[model samples]
Target: MKGFVKNYSGIIWLLTGIALGSIAGLIFGKKVEVLKPIGDIFLNLLFTAVIPLVFFAISSAIANIKPSDKLSRMMGFTAIVFLATVLISAILTIVAVKIFPIHEALGNAQLSEKIEDSPFAEQLTKLFTTTEFYELLSRKSMLAMIIFSIMIGFAALKAGKAADQFVGFLHSGNEVFKGVFILIMKAGPIGLGAYFAYQVGVFGPQLFGTYAKSLGLYYGFGAFYFVVMFSVYAFVAGGIKGIRRYWKNNLIPSATAVGTCSSIAVIPSNLDAAKKMGIPEYIANVTIPLGATLHKDGSSISSIVKMAVVFALFGKGFDTADAIVLALGMTVLVSVVEGGIPNGGYVGELLFISAYGLPIEALPPAMIIGTLVDPMATLLNATGDTVASMVVTRFTEGRQWIDKAI
Candidate 1:
């Protein structure tokens, strides 16, 4: 039993969490509200490590660049690919919402207070600030910290031995936090199960049916998108055989993405899959690390779903040209800042309430859609990250290069 668990702890924990949460939710129904604390505790624990996690993760990735020239080229190509996917995903998401058409009526506003309005210029500036150095610990301003960390990483490249020592320390901390993250995940089944249970208890399985249509539409679109995009890219990079090989090797990473619902959490598994698929170390390393945060195609699609759902629930329409642009802009913004935010699930809520000027009542539904689509979103994002590396390797090196067994 010990050997079995030691070998399959991740798989075991994931299945257990799902089963427990589902059972609990069904047994207690709305009474599962009592389990809220258990879920919240898990969320809080994840939150506590996020600050250190972001700082070290980003900085370490940047600090490893041996030559600035290579860094620039890799970043330029990866960024172009990442941006293209995000832009296209956002456009498609809008189209999907239009095709499906959520017709739910608006409910009363949930919260009375509003975020103090800021000029659009100020909001853009807030995305990367020079001030509020201390607030990063509490995640009051993550965008600023991301900016700061990047600057630090670039500076470390030129600062010589002292900088190397500092970055080494940072990398060490990054590894420690990664280990901490995995440790926390050991409790995932308990935490997420309870969280899901609380959700089920409050809303009941019947309630999911109300959301299943709109959310289901998004998932269906995601499946179609994945099959088409990944199949094309995989075949382009490695041929028909390559396509089969990529999927065969990708099972572990895909499951991890769904189970953990975290891009960073699945990094190790993704890295292993990349090696199995025979992508070069240079391409895989840089792309996967940066892509995890910046390449959020899933979030882009989810943001569209979020805005579309929120607008419908708020009695607004995506009818006018202005409404369409607002949806596009909000989708892009939410997806971009998502990786930078702590407990980024609130990202949709923050943008809708503050930027789009939707009433607070839209928040609950936004939150609901976020929870429902997250696993799929993460799965798409993770898969995209791997495929990106494959494409990059094929471009930089050659074609039909990977093994099917992998």
Candidate 2:
């Protein structure tokens, strides 16, 4: 018992805090919201540190790879696996919504502010590139920052001996940021507890009728995917043995993701889990951080739910052939570009409204759903990266990769 407690002390404290906060929320109601600032502080600290963390971690991974072929192969397998998993998630959501139908009347909510829908080309341009260097410092330009980091990494790799010091600096910076992440996480118990208090206390009663129905479907589907689909991915990656290994090491990251509700914030835990699962350092380093930015299975699922709900609100059918095709495509794109931050679905929600030519009034409901489901969505998005690393390892290192890792 002592050994078990020692091993899981952090998780224990976190869960304890969450449990206490939830009870307080239930008993005290809206008054519990006063604790929300602690949670906000925690999230703010993470967002502030994440940009540099991503830059240093990704660039350092690229710079340290001596063989270009190895890097290329890993990247290739990573892309294939990411696409496969995200598409599977989107497809599963579509099928679920179709079988059980989730759309209901969300009532008429007026839009106070006009939405200036940008052109698709301009949106894509902004997604990948920023005019000013300082803009990349913001979380909104996460994809652009990732792209810039990759370019810098390649430049350093090609620069050969002259870039040795630069590469070392990158490594040092990566270590420093990682240390920063650890320091921030030390406050997870109180921070996440306070956040959960506000969520349950302030927003608890708002879930009713259609909103409750949508959440049930989303939460149900999310649970099924998290358990069944993740298990399937694990088995395929390493058979029965893989399944055992994955679940054993996944709990920490899973809980952390649920508590934090941010994929980028969960990267450290996922990377640590990947290591314990015997994933190669190179694969874990590249895939986990990059996956946080580029891959979002959970968001893909939410995108479909949001679309179906919007379609239903407008008294339109979501099951039309064109709607399904367009929704799946947009979900894939949205998953790639969405920030790994909390409530990152805002941009994707706007895009969804614009793509379907829906009224700006449609945005608020979807955003509400996004917020309500963000924790579970983030759980799948963040933890999926670890299993994805295993899948990538399976492909790149061959079928016997798990045995070799052991």
The prediction achieving the highest lDDT against the true structure is: 2
- Model 1 residue 215 distance off true place after TM-score fit, in angstroms: 4.6
Task: Write one digit per residue (lDDT tens) for candidate 1, span 19-123.
Answer: 678678888788888887887786677657656776776677678767667667766777777777788888877777777775443233212333343455665
Clashing pairs in 1: 17-189, 29-201, 30-201
Worst 10 residues of 1 by lDDT: 105-114
Model 1 misplaced regions, further than 4 Å: 1-32, 68-75, 101-122, 202-206, 227-406
Encode model 2's per-residue lDDT on 223-331: one tens digit a residue. 9999999999999999999999999999999988876667887899999999999999999999999899888989999999988877766655676666676677779
Question: How many clashes does each candidate structure show, in the order listed?
Answer: 3, 0
Q: What is the Cα-based lDDT of residue 360 in candidate 1? A: 34
Per-residue error at 21 for model 2, in Å? 24
Per-residue error for 271 in candidate 1, Å, reads: 11
Instruction: Please list the C-alpha lDDT of all candidates, in the order they appear.
Output: 0.69, 0.78
How many steric clashes does model 2 contain? 0
